[model samples]
Target: MRLAIANLHASLGGARVLRDLTLTLEGNHFIGLIGPNGVGKTTLIRAIAGLIPFEGAITLDAAPIASIPPRTRARQIAYLAQGAESHWPLSVTRLVALGRLPHLEPFRKPQAEDEAAIARAMQLADVETMRTRDVLTLSGGERARVLLARALAVEAPLLLVDEPVAALDPYHQIGVMEGLVAYARAGRMVIAVLHDLSLAARYCDRLVMLNDGNVFADGAPADVLTPANLREVYRVNAEVTGEGRAMTVRPTGQI
Candidate 1:
């Protein structure tokens, strides 16, 4: 799968959030979309998912996103939105099964293939043990994993997640990141909006830094998370250390 965005512009509430942004991405790797607050990371993902209107072209496999049907788009991009917390009393398995909707017929029940996908998703996310648990009763991390399972159940080639590790314990955070990496390595593409710079540096094969509606930097984590970028884009004095999964970005002071 290949995604290309050209001169992309997007707005919400009549206020533009992305401007003249362009990016190209392919499958089989994990990418981190890093940026300051309200800098259009979410907007970019929504545009790619065809959930919002954009002024430029977004194409998958060279096909315009607007030309793709809603169900077909849903089957291609599995988007796990931010703050997907649910208050309903649905079981984790049932919640995860919802991801298969795009592949099912109208008013039809899950078939063998759908069930296999749901079970594989649960296994990949390591949430199989909690399959019968109430999603609402799970801890913050557990809920996040279950939600991830739901997204994974779609078996989409491209997965987009927003803040997959927010408000989680360190252990669970690592688990989620590891799961994403594994998914990417398994011939899929994963792009996640991340605020945890260190985790982004450690886990992502590539990083795209956005600021003020444009890409400030794009490359490997080490190159993109430089002290200069940390200071300029994030306005902080940070120390960048190590390389690849061992790399760390530690902020020392506000710039």
Candidate 2:
């Protein structure tokens, strides 16, 4: 699948978050959306997911995203928002099953295919052990993984995740990143907003850096995560080492 955007502009509460942003996203790749805080990373994905109003052309597989039916778009893009909270006392399994709503008709029970998808999503997020637990009772980290499982259960071609590893420990962070990479390798597109620059460099093949409400750099991690780019976009004197999948970024001092 392919998503093309041109001259995109988005705002929240009348404050412009993105301006004249143009980009193209496709499947079979894991992309990292990285930048300092409040740089429009979330806004860009929200616009792509059609959660907010925007001025521009955002087309999915050549068809305008706005023109697609709501249910149809729901089946195409799965979004995992940052800091997802659930107050409902539903079981983890039941919460994850909500992702299949796009596929199941009203009042129709989940079939074998839907069950399989939910199972796989739970397993990938490492939340299968807690499937019987109450979603509202899980810890912050656990809740994040459960939400991720819900998005994965959607089985959409495009996945937009906001800070998938933000609430996790180091082990789970690495594991979640690996799962995202695997999902992209499995012929899907995964765009994750990441604050850990080193992790982003290590796991994401492509990095899109946003600054001043636009894409400042877009390319392979090695090329986009350079010290100069970090200095300019992040205002930090940084060191970037290694190459390719082994790339790492370290901020030494403020610029």
Candidate 3:
């Protein structure tokens, strides 16, 4: 699958948040969208998910995503919002089952295929042990994993997640990131908005660096995460060590 965004512009409360943004994304790799706060990473994900109105064009596999019916679009893209929370006290399995909504008939119970999908998603997210627990009762990190399990249940061709590892300990953070990367390597598209520069550099196959509502750099981690770019956009002193997937990012101080 391919997502094409051209000349995209978005406004929030009469203020332009994304300015002439454009990019094309293909499946089968983990893509990270990184930028300073208020640079429109969240807005960009919203636009791509068809959750907001935007100017210019966004298409999936040559068809305008805006023109696709909501149900069909839902099947094409699975979106996980930033810091997602569940208000209902639904069981974790029940919550994860919601991802199959687009595939099921109204008022229908989950079919065998849906059951398989839910179980697979839970296994991948390492939330199977908590399947019977109430989502509201889980800890911050546990809830994050369950929500991620819900998103993964969709098994959509394209996955757009906002901060999939926001509230987890370092262990689970790396675990979730590894799961996302493995998901992409299994031939799914995973695009996430990540604030942790080191993790983004280490996991993402490509990094799209945004600044002031524009793409400042787009390429391999080594090329885009330069000391100069970090100083200018992130206002941090950082360095990259090693190479390839084994690379590590170390931040020394503020610029």
Candidate 4:
């Protein structure tokens, strides 16, 4: 499956957040979206998930996502939002199981397959130990992984995650990123918004850098994360090093 965004634009409170953005993501690809704050990365993800009204075309497997209802879209696309909050005291397992709701008949109970999916998702996210814990009682990193598990439980071919590792410790951050890489390798399209440039360079198959509501750069990490691009878009000077599957990025100074 391929996820394609064409001529996309989004506005909030009469302010345009995304302008004429377009991109394509194929299955088995891990794409990283990066930019300075307030560049519309989150808004792009939300627009693709149909959580906001936007003028554009978002297609999954060549089918226009805008033509589908939110519930229908949920079955094909899974989204893990940045700073997601759970007000209710739902158990971890129960929260993950909610991903199956889109597939169940109205008022239908969880079947054997649903239970298996939730269990698998929990195991993959390394949150099986927290399965029975109250979601509100978990740490920030734990909660983020749990929410990721919930999204995985949907088994959607297209996964959109916004700043998925923002609150994680270094170890857990790498763990979660590797998990997403594995997911993409297993024939799913994974798109993640990230602030850490090094991790994005290491784990993502491609990079899309946004600036001022437009795509500033899009291509392989080496091409998009160059010193020149970083200086121009992020207003910083940085040295990008490493070779042959290993990359390191360090900020040298303000531009």
Top of the candidates by TM-score? 2
Give the C-alpha lDDT of model 3: 0.92
Stretches of candidate 2 exceeding 4 Å from the true structure: none
- Kindly state the number of residue pairs that clash in model 2: 0
Mark the regions of model 1 whose C-alpha exceeds 4 Å error after superposition.
Answer: none
Candidate 2 lDDT over residue span 60-106, tens digit each = 99999999999999999999998988889999999999999999999
- TM-score of every model? 0.96, 0.98, 0.97, 0.95
lDDT winner: 2
What TM-score would candidate 1 get against the native?
0.96
- lDDT comparing candidate 2 with the true structure: 0.93
- Give, for candidate 1, the lowest lDDT window spanning 10 residues: 167-176
User: Which is the better candidate, 3 or 4, if ranked by lDDT?
Assistant: 3
Give the per-residue lDDT of model 1 (tens digit) for 1-255: 899999999999999999999999996989999999999999999899988999989999999989989899899899999988878899999999999999999999999999999998888788999988999899988998899999999999899999988967898789889988988998889999999999999999999999999999999998899999989999999989898778988899996
* Two-way TM-score contest, 1 vs 4, winner: 1
TM-score, prediction 2:
0.98
**Regions more than 4 Å wrong, model 3:** none
Candidate 4 minimal-lDDT segment of 10 residues:
242-251
